[model samples]
Target: MTNTNFLISGKLIDIVSREIIKAELEIKEGQIVSIRKKESVPDRYILPGLVDAHMHIESSLLIPSRFANLAVQQGTLGVVTDPHEIANVLGEIGVDFMINDAKKVPIEIRFGVPSCVPATKHETSGFVLDSNIVESLLKREEVVCLAEVMDFVGVVEEDLEVLRKIRACKNLGKKVDGHAPGLKGQNLKKYVASGISADHECSNIEEALEKISLGMMIQIREGSAAKDFEALYPLFDSHPEKIMLCTDDLHPDDLIENGHINYLIKRGLKKGLDLFSLLRAATYNPIQHYGLDLGMLQLGDPADFIVIDHPESFVVEQAYRKGKCIYKDRKVLFETNNDIILNNFSRKSILLSDLQVKPQNGSLHAIVVKDGDLLTDSLLCEPKIDNGNVVSDVENDLLKIVVMSRYDNGKPVMGFAKGFGFKKGAIAESIAHDSHNIIAVGTSDEDLLHAINTLIDMKGGIVAVNNGDREAVRLEVAGLMSNKTGEDLISDYTRLRKFASGLGSSFESPFMTLAFMSLLVIPKLKLSDKGLFDVEQFKVINLFKDL
Candidate 1:
C-alpha cells in the first residue's frame, strides 16, 4: 500500500531513551513507517530536525518565506516565534501576514499570539492586541501559546488587564510565556505562580538555575544583540531537561556568518556535553514543551527529521519535512520570497535644532551601551555645554541619542548615550523596539539630523550618514521587515554596516545594537520618544541630572 518508500540507514538517535541504535528508517507517504535494527554503524546520525525555542522572525529582517530558506540551511526545521515586533507595528494584520507568508514554505513556524501589543503605555506604537484580540487569535489554527508576558510587574502586582490575557490563554489550555529578565527570589516564585512556564531573559547561570528550580524553562539565547549562551550553557549538563536554545533577535548577517540553533549545538559539543542531551535541547525538548507536531522519527509520526554527520561535527547532511528533501549539504531546496515592499510611513523631516539637548547644571543621565548585550547601565556624566546647548562630546565618546515617534505623530526626544564609540557621523534605524520609533545616535546634531531624516525620507529603514556619504537599507514592510530574499537583505544590510564601520563603529551587528537603545524594558537606562527613561526607577528622567 506504500506509494513512495525510502530507506535511510544510520545511527538513529533515540530521543526518549537517549541512546543510538544502528537502524534503517523506512518512510512512506510523508510518515515514518518503520525503524528496523541493523548490524552496521553508519557514517551519519539521523534524528529529529532542529528547533529554535524562541525567536522573532522579523528580527532576521526577512519575511517568513525568505527567513525559512535561511533557517533550514542551519537545520532549523521549526521556530517558536513571538511576532510581537511586527504585531506591535501592524496588529492582527501583521500577525496574519506572517502566517500567510509562512504557508508558502515548509518550515513549521509556530507563532505565539502577541500577549502585549504596544508592550507598554510608555511610548507610541501602531496597534494594540488586547485580551479581546488575544482571545480571538487563540482560536486561530496557527496560534499555539500566549507570547511572552513582558509586563512582569503586572503579573507580580496582579494587574487586572495583564492577568486577564494570561487567564484567557489558561482558560483555553494554552501555554503562557515569560520575559522576566533578571527576575529572582520571591518575585520569580510569584511570576511562575501565574502560569508562565518559560523565560528567555536569564542573563546568568545562577539566575537560570534558580528559575529552573522553580519549574520555569530557561531558554539559552545568543542572538545579534543579547548574547546569553556563555552564561547559561552550563545548563546543558547541569539541567538539560529545563533548558532550550533560542535567538531572541537575529540579523541576516548573523544567520549567514554564525548560524541558528546549530551555532549553540557546536559550542555545547566543544564543551564535551553528552550528545544525547545536546540534541534533545536542540530538537526534542521544544517539541515536547510546546506540544509541537515536529517528529522524532517515530513510526506513524510526520517524517520531519534530519540526517546529520556524527557528534564530532554534527553537520546536518540532509533535512526533511513531510518526507520531502528541503535541505541538503548546506544548501536549502526551498524557494524564498522576492522583492515585495509594503510599509506604513509618512515622511516628516526635522531641523538640526530639534535634535539639541540644552545644558543644565546637573549630572547627565546617559545610556551606557554594551557591545552584544541588551542590558545597559545608567551612567552619570557631566554635561558638555557648547553654544548654549548640551551637545554631544565626541572627544569624550558621549554622543546624542534620539527617539522620534513615527506612529501617533510626535517629535524627537533628545538624550545622551555613552559607549557607541563613534567619533563622527550618525546612525539611525526605524527598527527601535516595542514602539519601534526611529532611534539615532550621533556625534553631533548635524550628523544625527541627517541620519534620522534619511530614514524619514525612506519612510522606514536604517540609515547611516558619515561626513557627506550616506547609506540606507529600507525595511518597507511595517518598517520592521523586508520582503526581499535573505541574500539581498544580508547584502543591503552589510553595506550599511560597512558604511557605519567606515566612520568608527566596531560593535558587532551595529544596527541591531542601535535598535535596542530605545527598548524601555530590559534596561537600566534607555531612550524612548517620551524622554530619557530611568527603567529601574520606571519613570522618564530628564536629560540633565540637575534641575
Candidate 2:
C-alpha cells in the first residue's frame, strides 16, 4: 500500500531547465504538491520516468500487463504503443483487450488507431478496420493517435480511403504516424502533407535529416531486429527536439537481456551525447508530442519519477508511478493476472505434399535477409530440381520459405529465401509481421511441415523442429502475445531461440527475421500469404522470372 501523503529528497535532474539541484518533494494524492530546495540530499538522482515514443507491445511476446511488469523495472512509466499486430488478427476486440489489460497496471499506456488493418491488399488478415472503424476507435478516450500508416504508396497516390483515415485523425486532433522507409523528396513531402507527422523507419541520418526538414519527427529506433539508433544517434546533437526514441518491435529476449529506453540512454551517454538532450528525447518530447498525461516531475503533475544511483552508472534504483512505488531494489512491486486468453487461429496440420513446389521454366526470386535489418533484398537463383519439383539448395544457403493463412485452411504460398543459414531443421511462427500469419523457413519439406504443425497444434506460437526434437513458446493471446510472467516468457523464449540456433541458424534473431518475411510493406522483396510480393512495384509477382 502507498501512503497518500509523503515526502522525499534527492538530486532532482530538471530536463526542461537543464540543471540538477538538491531538492525535497512533497507528494499528496498521487500528485506532486510542492518542491523545496535543500542544502543536502541523498546521493540518488531523481528524474522523470522514461517513455517509449512508439512501439508495438505485442512485439514483446507478452500481453500489455506482463510487458508493464518488466518495463516498469526499467523505469518505463508510460508508453505510446500501436496495437497494429493484434488488430490485424482480432480487429476492435484486440484493441479493447490491450486497453483493458493496460488498466491492470500502473504504467500509462496510450494506444493508437491502427491505420492499416490488413496492412496491404496483397495479404490476408482475420479482420479489417476500415475508415469508419478507425474513426470510431479514434473517438475512444484511450486512443491518442493513428498508428503507423504503412501504405505510403496510397498516400502518395492520393488514395481516398487512406486520406479518409488521416482526415479522421486530424478532425479528432490526433496525430498520424508514418512507416515510409527510404521514401524521399516529393513522395516524402506528399506523405507528410497527408498529416503523417512522424516516422520511425529512417535508416540513416541523411534520411532522418530530410524528414526533419519537412517538419516530421524522427523516432530513432533500436529494436530486436531493425536497429537504427547507431545510424541516427547523431540526431541527439543535430536535432534533439525534433527526435524521439523508440523500439518499434522489441522481442522478449531483448527486453530481458538488455533494457528498453534506458538502454538507449546508456548507449547515448557512451557515445558522448548530451545527457539532458537524450532524456528530453526519451521523456519530454514523446510526452508532449502524444499529449500523454504522464508527469515530468513538475508541480501539480502526477508523481511519476525514478530514482537512479548516479548519472554515470544510470542504474534505476526505484520507479514510482502516480506517487506509488512500482519497482525498487531490482524487483517489480506489482503482480499481473494471467486468466485472460484470446486468439484467432484456425490453421490445421499440413502434409508434405502441401510444401511441394513444381519446377518453373526460369530462375526464382529469393528474399535475401540480413542479420539485424528489416529490409530484404531480391536474389535470382536456379531452382534445384528433385523428383521433378523444386527443392532447397542448402549448400548455397538457399532455402524454402512459405506463408500460410492462419485464419483459414488456405493453400500455402511458397517462395525461396536466403540468409537464414539454417542447415538441418526448420523454424516457424504465427507472429508474422503486419498480417500475423504463419511463416516458416527450412531446408527440408518434412521439417517445415512438422514445425508449422507444432504451431497449429498449440494454436499460435513460435516453434523450432529438427530431426525428431522440437521446442516452442506458446502465445495464446491473439496469436501475438502470452499471458505468462515476463521472467517465464523470457526464459522460454531464450531456450526456444537457443534450440533454433542449434538447428544451424547463425542470425541473432532468426524468428524475428522470419516474422518480417511476410511484411509486404517493407522494401525490395517479401512474401505474403497471397503470394510473393514485389514491394517496389507494390504488387504480388510470380516467384519465377518471366520465360
Candidate 3:
C-alpha cells in the first residue's frame, strides 16, 4: 500500500480488543492501510461502522435505495434485512427486487431468504416461498442467512419444510435467524436444536437469557412496532459478547430524528451501561455472527467506520463505506433514483354490507392494542349491535377491523380492536403484517368503505378517511413500499397520521399499529383475509361464535 488516499485522525475504538487510543489511520484503495498512534487527534471518535443485525427495509415504507440513504447518515454502513414483507406479495421476484435495488447504493444490504411465506397456513398471501424457493435463494451470494422464522410452531415440531430451509442454509454455511416470541423450556430447546442461530423477539429478560444459554445469539430490538430494549438491556451486562442491536421495523421519522445503532448506544449509555459492552453490540457481534464483510477497523480490512463527537450521544458526524466518505455534516451522500414497479394487487369494489356479521353471542374477541407494544390481548367484550349485526362501539373506543385480500377478490374478514380511540372515521393501510392484506379499522361502515376503496384505487397504499376528508400515500411496489422521495413519503405518512388523529384516534403510531393488525403470529386474536383467527389456538373461528 502507498502512503494514503485519505488520512483520518481520531480516538480510535478497537472493538475486538475493547480499547480506545488516539490514533491516525491511512486508507488506500478502499482498505485501511495503516494505523499509527498519535499524541493528539481530532475532536472526534472513530469506530467500526454499525450494522442492523436484522431489519425489514419495506417496513420503513421506502425502497431499498432510499432506506439506505436514511440509514447511512445515522452511521449504519450496512443492514441484514429480510425482504419477507415484499416476498409475501411477489414471491421470488420480491426478494430479487430488494437485491437489485440494493446494488445501486454504497451501503451493504445482506438479504435473507424469507423462510416463511404466507407466514402461516391460516393466512392468504400473494406468494409462497416454499422449500424449493429457499434453496434457490441460498445459492445467491447476496442472500446471507435465512430470515427470522416467524413459524416457531413449524420449527418446534420439526416441520419438514422448515427444517429443510435450515438445512439449506447450513449446507451453504450460512446463519439462520429466529422470531420465537415468548418461547421457553422444551419448545425453545427444540427450536434452537434445529440450528437457529439468533432471535430478535424475546419479550422478557428470562426469555433472552434462556435463548442465550442454549447457544443462540439474542438481538435486542428497538423499532417502531416492537420496542424490547427495556427488558433485554440487562443482557448487555450479563452476556455482552452474545448480544446484537437492531431496529427490526423502524419508521422514517424515528430514523431521521434519532440515529440508528447510534441511537441504541446513546440509550444504553444513558441507562449506565459499560461503553465497551454497548460498542460490541453495535460493531462486532452482528458482523461476527452473520460473517458480514463489514470491517472491524483493522489494517487491511474494509474501511467501514463512522466519526462521532463522543460516546455519550454517539452523534455521527461522518460515515465512510469502503474508505469513501458517504455521510458528512449530517447528510448522506448517495445518488437518488426512485422507480415504481407494480407487483401484485387486486382492485375489488367492496361495500359496508359485505363486512357485516352478527355475533352468535354478545361477547366478541377484540384485539387490545397496547401503546408502544406489539403484543396484543384478546378481550371478550359485549359489543353494541344494530339489527342483526354487531357494530363498532365508539363510546368504548372499540372499533371494527377488516382484513381484505389485496391479491385476489375475497370476502373481507371482520373483527374488532380496542384502544384505537377514534370516535369517527377509519384508517387503512395496505402493508398489513405478514400477509400484507389491506387492513382497516373504523368507527363507521361508511368510513371503512372509503378507506378500503381509496387503497384499492391507489393500487396499494395507506389511506385515512375522516368524515368526508381523505388522504393517502400509494405504495405501488408490492403494495408495501413507495418510490417517492424520502421527503414526500414522510410528508404523506405524517398527513395520513394527522388525518387519523383529527378523527380522535389516540395511538402513538397509527399506521404501523394498523399494519400489525393481521400479524397472527404475535398472539391473542387477529383478523386475516381468510377469517377471524385465534392465534392462541392457531385456529380460525367465526366472530359470531360464543367463547
Candidate 4:
C-alpha cells in the first residue's frame, strides 16, 4: 500500500453509519489502500458513486460508449444492463456488440444473460437464444447473472428451455432476475421458487410489497415504459435496506435532461425521502446486490466517489472512477469511437392490402394502451366497415394499429389496436419493444402503408407518415440504438414530436408511446413480431376470431 498515487481525505459518511466522520483516504492504482485520521477533514462529502441497479443500454438510444459518457456525468460508476432489445434484433452478434462497446468505457458494466430473446415462443425475432447460447454467455467474465426472466409464464410451467437456461446460470453461481408484472398468489410463489432472486417490473405498491415479502430485491423502476416512482418511493422509509434504484429504459432526451440515477435521487428528495437512504439505495445496496467491484470511499475499497457541490440540489461537481476524473460539470472525457453496425432487417413494403381484415359479426377485439401506463386497457370496438374494407376513423378516435414481422419470418402477423390518439395520417416505427417489429398507426390505409415503407427505407428507426409524404429517422445501429449523442437525438426527436402533434395526436411523446407496441409482457393486449398477444392469458390469440 506504499505505492499510493493520491491521498483523498474528506468528510465521509458510510451508508451504514448513523453518524458522519472525518476520514483520510489513500488510493493506489484504482483501489483504495487505507483510510486513517477521522478528526481533520471539513468540506467535501465522500460517498460511493451511484450504481444503476437495472437498465437497458439500448433504451438510451445511444451506443454503450456514449451512454457511458452521459451516465458517468451523473456519477454512475456501475450499471447492470440487460441488452435484450438489441439481442432480440441481432441475436448473439448483438450481444457481442454490447460487450465490446461496454469494455471501452471506464465504468463497470455488468452484462445480464438475456433470459428471453423472442421473449415468448409466440413472437418473431432476428435470432433466437436457446439454452446453449445462455450457457455460453454466462461463461463470459463480464456476465453478472440472468437478465430479467421475462417469460415468467414459461418459467412457472417449467418450460424445458427456460428451465435449462435458469439452471445454467444457477450452476455457475450467478443470480437470476425476474419480470413478473401483476403476478400474485401461487403463481408468484412458483415464479420465485425457480431460483430467480430479484424483480424490477413491479407496477404498484402492492406488487412491490409482495415481491419484497417473498425475499426478492425490488429495483424501483422509473423508465420510459414502466414508471413506478410515486407508488414505490414510500418503500424507502420502511425497507430502504432491501430497496434499489434503476432506470429500466430511459430515452436519450430524458437521460440528458433528467439524468440516469441522479434524476431519481432528485425526485426522491423532493418527495421528502431521507438523503442517506436514497444514497444507500442508489449506491451501496446495488453494488452489494450485484457483487460489483465499484469501490466506495472507504478504507481498502476503490477510490470511486463523486464530489458533490450541493447534496440538496444533487449537483454532481465532478465524477471519479478508479480515482480518475471522468466527468466534470456537464462534460465527459472518454475515448469513444462508437462504430455503427447496421444490419438491414426491414421487411418488404407492407401496404393497406396487407392489413386487410375480414368481417366479424360479433364483438371486435381491440388492443388499447392507457395514456401514461405501459399496461394496456383491453376493450371491444365495433368494426367500422367502409366500402367492404375495415377503415380507421379519426373522429371516433379509433385509428388502426398494425404489427408486422420484419425478421423475414415469412408469415407476418398483423393486429388492430385503438387509443393511440392519431388524428390525420399515420406513424410507423422499427423501435417496437422486445422484438423489433414494424408498428404503424394511421388514419387511412395509404398513410399506414406509407409510414411502414418509410421505416423500411431507413433500415431502422421511427417515421411519421402524413398523407402521401413521409419523414424517416434512421437508427441504423442494430435497429435498436443510434451512435449519436443526446443533443442530436433530441433534435431529431423534436421533429418527430412536432410532426405527430401537428397531426392532432394528444400524447406528450407519441413516438415513445408507439415504441411499446410489441411488448408482450405488459397486460391487456399488444401486437408482437408474431401475432396478437393477450398478456393476461399469456398466449397468442386470433386477431379476427374470439376464443
Instruction: Report the lDDT tens digits of candidate 4 across residue range 16-124.
Output: 6644667887777877888786777757776788998999988887888888877877778899999898888888888998999899988989999898888877777
Looking at candidate 2, the ten consecutive residues that score lowest on lDDT are: 310-319
Question: Please, what is the TM-score per model?
Answer: 0.97, 0.98, 0.97, 0.94
**Which order, best to worst by TM-score?**
2, 3, 1, 4
Give the per-residue lDDT digits (tens) of candidate 2, residues 299-323: 8989999999976677889988889
Model 2 misplacement above 4 A? none
lDDT of each: 0.85, 0.92, 0.87, 0.80
Best by TM-score: 2
What shift in Å separates residue 523 of candidate 1 from its native position after superposition? Answer: 2.2
Output the lDDT of residue 233, model 2: 92
Error of 4 at 327 (Å): 1.1
- lDDT by residue for model 3 over 1-547, one digit each (tens)? 1223989899999988889999999999889989999999998899988899999999888999998888887788879999999999998888888899899998888988999998998888889889998999999999889999888999888789899999999999999999988889999999999989899998899889999999999999999878899989999889999999999998887888777888999999999999999988987888888888899999899889999899897778998888888889867777869686866987588987897876675487788987778788888788888888788889998899999888888888889899888888898988899989889999988899988998898888888888778988888888888898777888888877777788886677888888887998988778898888888799998676475
Ten residues in sequence with the least summed lDDT for candidate 3: 1-10
Query: Per-residue lDDT for 1-547 in model 1, tens only?
Result: 1235788889888887888899998888888888899999677888888899899999998888989998888778989898898888888888899988888888888889888778777888888988899888987777778989999888999998899999988898888899988888899899999999999999988888888889998888999999998888788878889988899899999997888888888888788878878888888889888888798888889889888886566677898998888888777877775566656665489997787666778788888998999899987898888989888898898988889888755778988888889888999988999878889998888888888888888888889998777999888888988888888888998888888897786788778898888878787898888988877887888777665
